[model samples]
Target: MSNRGETVNIAIFTNSYLPFSGGVPTSIKTFKNAAEKLGHTVIVFAPSYPGHKSNGKGVIRIPSVKAMTYAGFYLPVPFSTEITKAFRRYDFDIVHVQHPYLLGETGMKMARKYNIPLVFTYHTMYEQYLHYLPVAESIANPVMRKFTTSFCNHSDLVIAPSEHVKEFLSKRNIETSIKVVPTGIELRPYRKKFRKGSIKRKHRIPQASKLLIYAGRITPEKNLKFLVKCMAKIAKKDPDVMCMLIGKSAEKDHYEYDLKDIVKREGMEDRIMFIGDVPHDKLIDYYKEADLFLFASKTETQGLVILEAMAAGTPVIAVDAPAISEFINGKNGFTVPQNMLKFTAKALSMLRDKKRMKQMSSNALKTAKKHSAENMAKKLIAEFRKVKPTQDEYENMRSLKDLSEIDWSDVIKKIMR
Candidate 1:
């Protein structure tokens, strides 16, 4: 193992990456950028996107086909000669994977081959997103749960983005060592001062309008229809309030149309604006311009955008969920129950109280500072150090006749428990 302060070489395998906008890609990018700055080397293996050119410095693109279930995402081919060549060239101390299947499985195989410690970051609630699978939910849910549990057990370290996720994995009987290291954001951009109302001015919204912003992929799992209902209620109570949904819809599932339709039905066409696909660098300006950040997604493991909004000093009003309830308090923001009436009431109350909002905004900034990229990267490095094998351990692992010795029946028995 490398010395405590010595640089470590990292191999990251993920099903998704740059040019694809989502939490997984964003988290990978953030960690890569921050870790590189700290003199560590990170090589990422990800699916190649059509018409997207990669710089090819540290990222290796695996040939992939577009997934039928997910519109924009591509399914990576498991076997790659390029990845084999990379293993021969780079001496990786640890292999970190972002998903449990496909590319993640490949990562596991490669880690075993090289006798490197394996780390898996459970970035999503697989069961919550099983609707994307062509198989029936009843069959898919339990199978996915079992598969993920087995995968986590195989990993040397399992990273949860929040304490709730860690607890959830424990309940599912994941025997691997679990750590909570949230996807962190660069604090400078959010902390920097920008022209306050630039986003509103660009969208032709009045400067005095109270803007409520929600940023993320527009998919069914996000529960955006509920947010529209909440927005409609808030708009009815305050004529000066407006909402901006700042993301594009999934390629296959254009749920944004449904949201627009709901907005129209609520008679909020003028009040609710669909500002689609803003660049990540420019998103901080929108967050800064917003009076409050609105999030209703119950499926989130970390709700990364909520933290991004808080980083920009925007108080968030989120629906109570395991991950959300961990950070959002009365000081930073409010996390109300899923009930629309209660959620909307808290939002309206917060909007009406200027002094309280200002105090919360200050508290939110402090909260964001605690989750900065540098801090999270240090935590990740520490975990990596704990799991990384020494030279003698690596040699012993390499001497093993077969690395794929896990019993599926045993994994199933544990899942049943």
Candidate 2:
């Protein structure tokens, strides 16, 4: 623990970090920035990206190689002596890990060695992502579930991004204390004024076009094919409506090619535009410029992009899932089942109604205000304090023998089996 009053030293371990604009990286950056503003030290231990260099202040990059299965992601070489030496220097009060494998296992070992609390955030629905593996779904799904569940059970505390995610972990028989802490958004950027039609002008989209947008990684698990189908249906009714997808494919699964093929088959290439990976600051403006924010992902734990769109005073029309249902209601946005007919109908209805759209836009902004980054940081800090070790316990832990060497490959193989 830090000598400073009410402040604690935090060590965050994540497989992914900056230069990757996925939910896990975004969530880690959001919490780290907000927590630092509230007077705490956060050191991120993440995989090294190819050309990206860390400032080497709060962030520690580990040696890694590019993953063959997943694009724009690196697999950490977990047995680095430099990382071990650097980790021993910090008197971390609690260890927070964003994933349950690779770096996550290293975090668990470090926490055990130091006798600090191991806190795991249930970020992704891991089983849904088994398509990345070469193994069959039937074989991979059970292994993934077991691997993640065991990690959660070992952790002293587990953080779920939403109440629905908490329920999910509980059902998995995760025998650890779970807390709901949705990744917070910085509201200041959303409040700033930006010129209207700037995005349309830049993209050569017509100024009078009704813009619908989706932001996140273009991957298989995101259910982007359904979104393309919905856009095709909407285009038939409204000639002026255009859908802009603002993200790049972060996986080598060729899902982007599949989506483009569908768009071509439907003969709606002009109606749908793929605007890959907008910077976070600029993405807010894109969200604000859109008339509606469309999401079709069924596997999000707590769709952070949905909240971002809401922050920009844009109403969402998302496929109904546990996390999506919590935020998207009749007041702020509409939630529909996975049915394409129902989703397109809701989207078309919202676009045609001016008065109702205005009311929902106002409601969306109000909803976003309640989820400010500061509030979520405070909640996260509270959770850290709850699991922090006592002074005597900390002292005793330090006196204990050093952690033994581990064969990571063997451990991983055992877990997979």
Candidate 3:
């Protein structure tokens, strides 16, 4: 580690970054900004996006190709000489990687080559998102687990956003020192004041109508179809209830079309509104205007969006999943099984109780306070200090596996042909 009181140089590697708006990018930005405030020198290494200008500060965007399977996401062009030389020049004290995909492997090689301590953050539950790929579900899940286990095992330490994620790594037999680090949010934005009736009036929603908001990308893993189905039941019982989805999908033509079809087929078009992606600064206003926030996704590592809603003083109604269960409960928010009947009933009950909603809103604000960015940065700095590079450890060729031994040539030929 650096001499006492000296700032440690950190290089964070990821498949995506700015000009892209999603959970991963948001997490990187949050941690990067917070870490810098604590006097740490940090730089981001991410894939370059076409037609977007990257501010040449502490970030390096490497050349990559747009992935065919996933929209607006790029896969780094393998074996980039520029990437290899860039790492050699920076000589980062620690290499932090967000995912265990292609760029991540390069990070591992560089870390080992320089004898730098490496850390991996388990950000997403890849098994739950096999539908996004063209591969067969049965084949993809086991491959994902195997790949994740290998990548995590090679790291000096692993960071899990919540205990739930740590437990998942444990279950998968990821033999690495794991730390629970919840990605903290900047609480200042949520604390700001916004025009009270702006969102409602802009959409022309009824003043008395109970506005239930869902904020995030519209995707299959988000279980938006289920939410729409539940809303259909709630609308029948209370016609004044309005469910507004406040984000757009990366593949808007695909996911958005499917969701709109559900709304029309159920004959609840007027009650369900797709208010496409609002500006991040204005997101707090949407949350503040909402009566209750609803999330059905079970694949979140920490559900940062739920915490953002809580910070905006909105109670949530979510599916009973690990990350969300950490803060959401009877006092702050409600969690129900994935059953449509039970979820619809609980949502309707919460909407009907004005006194209970007020109580839950107060509780949510308290919960949000416990997850400040300052606290998260301090915890991360402590972990960074603990990770010392062992002398002569990298010289042990047995501990570090050679990429050549894996029959990649044969596998690539068979798969590509």
Candidate 4:
């Protein structure tokens, strides 16, 4: 075997995948793409959603008996028989699970039944999901902690996307091997050029305006209302300050255009611009066009967009939270103390200082260089090599019973008849 190690096939399982348009989906795509480039065969199993396509190449959609459809897409519950059966035939060397709960649990089972080593990447803190699940913290927190710890402990390796998440995983007392590997950026040779000219013309952002760009989904966990609130405060002081709210909204009433209503009601509409979801291919243009990037989300295992903005030579202004604070330590960008008013004022300070803007751009570019796909691939490849199918388990998996003997004809007859 080459010193880089023998190429092993890996199957990744997640709740959502590409063309779904979210940070997690994008990170999943990036890893799959990078893994493939490293000569490892990679495939994913995810649900088909609206405006989402599954070519069925390297992807198998799970059938759900019960689903919660939203925006024309259905979320499959964990351990759907289709998923369990579909995975059995794949014969992967390793199963890497992303996200938590149902689908992740399915991955856990596959690792056991198929004798494949498993790895789990903890991408989000489900602390926010408890309220959505309508469960009290006393009940939900323990459950979340239990599942998280259990999942990590089951894995051959648990990859944390940020130092903050690694620490979080450690605190839960997950005894598995843990590694911190960043979701990397595909650095462009002419990326700096993409920054200098793209933002100014494409978005109609005036050269005189101090553009503050925010990327990613306009979701609740982002803590975006404060961004609007901060914009209003900044608008009160400087009319030339323009806040461009990019990305698709998660909730119509609670998240999106309503923010515009708030801005208009406050007579601050002129200062804040809501530009919905920018396509991935042209995202670099938006970064290049902006003078500074503003990210206030308290929820992130790692903010890939923050690195993207920095890659475009745009400094980020983010709340001092987890992954955000880990990558930015007052060197490449400014970190606010999660105080809304303070964040607004800190953003406001960037307006009058042209020299500081230029310095931050250089610093951002310098810091962003550390987060590249090659670096991440090295770490991920190491983890993949550390895991192997054992003699007994491998033999047992090959002898495991197939679902065909279970007689699913009754269920099919009931559904069709």
Candidate 3 structure lDDT: 0.82
| Top model number, lDDT | 1
What TM-score does candidate 2 reach?
0.91
Query: Tens-digit lDDT track for model 2 on 153-212?
Result: 777889999999999888988777999999998887777879999989999989999999
After superposition, which runs of candidate 2 have C-alpha atoms over 4 Å from their true positions? 1-5, 251-253, 388-417
Clashing pairs in 2: none
Clashing pairs in 1: none
* Candidate 4 segments whose C-alpha is farther than 4 A from its true place: 1-3, 54-57, 64-73, 77-91, 134-138, 189-205, 388-417
Instruction: Report how far residue 27 has shifted in candidate 1, in Å.
Output: 0.6
For residues 56-150, what per-residue lDDT tens digits would candidate 4 score against the true structure? 55776664332221232245445467666656665577888896555665776777777778788888887765554433567767666665665
Per-residue CA lDDT of model 3 for 1-417, tens digit only, reads 676567888988898887676888888888888888888878888888999885457888888776655567776644677666777677578888998766786777678788888899999998887776556789778777777787788788899999999998899777789999998887878767688878889899887778889999888889999998888888888988898998868668888898999999999999999998787788889999999899999999999999889988899999989888997978999999999999999999988899999999999998888887767877876787788553444445452344333332333333333
Best by TM-score: 1
Q: Give per-model TM-scores.
A: 0.92, 0.91, 0.91, 0.84
Q: Which window of ten consecutive residues has the lowest lDDT sum in model 1?
A: 392-401
Q: How much does each candidate deviate from the true structure in C-alpha RMSD?
A: 5.2, 4.3, 3.1, 5.6
Q: How high is the CA lDDT of each candidate model?
A: 0.86, 0.84, 0.82, 0.72
Estimate the TM-score for candidate 1.
0.92
- Give per-residue lDDT, candidate 3, residue 407: 37
The TM-score of candidate 3 is: 0.91
